[model samples]
Target: MSEETAARRQRPRTLRQRLQHFMRVRFWRMDIAADAWIAPTASLDRNWPRGIHVGENCVIDEWAIVLSHDYTRGLYRDTVIGPRSVIGTRAIVMPGVRIGADCRVEPGTVVSRDLVDGEHVAGHPARKVGSS
Candidate 1:
């Protein structure tokens, strides 16, 4: 393995350490369990609520924000991304949005609504661009 990869693996684990690691790094937390793969640059904010579940073979791209709370109202909810879905780069998934299986959310889309299975959505408000 490369030196940087090896060094990161060897780093010690602690509560403070994990917090610092989460803040400093731009990836899924080590404790986050996923059957899918997440890209290194994908960021999940520290203030994000719990119960973030990603299904099998999902791809969350860089700079995509998946939120589990409505910060303006202080409401907590779960954000579910179904299996084989692709959340494009810089997409903003709002609180309580349930994305269905095999859906493709285009880049820069702000998804605040639940998507049906095998749908393709795009744009700021996120409409159905195509059917899969």
Candidate 2:
């Protein structure tokens, strides 16, 4: 990482900011980049929060859901949202899914599998619609 970027990351989180991300970053042990934006209404899998990773500059919009576990199958797997990606409003990302860097997941879409870098996906099972 660039020196400036590293320094920015090292900067302390303000009380308000800490409170906003407390559930995922502190109590849940999720790996969310300092610059990532997770909307207040977004839902993350509390069952396996440690398995969820949100990369730098990623945005998880309102009502988006990112899962790291499936209680029905008793599975706990890592789910990754790569750098600069955007999880659109109300989207659902299934367990163990890895969304690559710079990708875009459209609103209300359900992602059940991995995505390559720069892909733009939409629909129930997240079909590729475009790419960056």
Candidate 3:
């Protein structure tokens, strides 16, 4: 590999740098708190640019999508994710959903409502399973 590619493999970019790059390249408008871990495959809604807020120490796993606009409902609202939480692989956070801190959303979940602090949920429509 070339020297630049080798250096890139040796040291991964910081979360801030990654976020900035995504904002620049993908044109996604999101407010991601420091220490957050957003997978490169995670998709944030770009149609509603200013409608996503992620708190510190959150993890958005691969293929996870955080949406902000509901075309079917003809609505647009903010989607919030936590100070400390994990959005599992392929999980979908629907428009306007608020995910509280210390929560864990298991894989393949479809969240349609607000999740309170310390809540752990899974499955379609995301029922409260237990505390995190």
Candidate 4:
């Protein structure tokens, strides 16, 4: 592992962080990394909790929705958010989408397709706006 990553693992967690981790891991059964920060209001797919995979150092901001299942379409697929990425506030990640590392999803954007590494996207249908 990198020195920075090793150092991060050694840091102690606060009570709130521990509680959140417990709820996310034990209760929700999501594959969120130890150092990832998920906002209290972030909505990970509850119906298919095992399908949501969040990588190390990811930040899922408030009201962001990492949706892994679409009941209307009878779809259930994994939604992967790569490491060192940020899902902006209220961003909606569609089912089966694989977001790449170092990407930034702008707020209120609806991501319906896979993202390449270091890509930044915005808009309702999620067009590529830039790269990291």
Most accurate candidate by lDDT: 4
Cα-lDDT of candidate 2: 0.85
- What tens digits encode model 3's per-residue C-alpha lDDT throughout 38-82? 777888888886898888767777799999998988999999997
TM-score of 3: 0.81
Per-prediction CA RMSD (Å): 8.0, 5.3, 7.4, 4.2
Structural RMSD, model 4: 4.2
Mark the 10 consecutive residues where model 2 has the least summed lDDT: 1-10
State the TM-score for model 1: 0.72
Off by over 4 Å in 3: 1-27
**Collision count for each candidate, in order:** 0, 0, 0, 0
Better of 2 and 3 by TM-score: 2
Scanning candidate 4 in windows of ten residues, the lowest lDDT window is 1-10
**TM-score sort, best first:** 4, 2, 3, 1
TM-score of every prediction relative to native: 0.72, 0.86, 0.81, 0.86
Off by over 4 Å in 4: 1-17
Question: What lDDT tens digits, residue by residue, belong to model 2 across residues 10-101?
Answer: 55655655687876787878899978877678888888879999999887878999999898999999999999888889999999999999
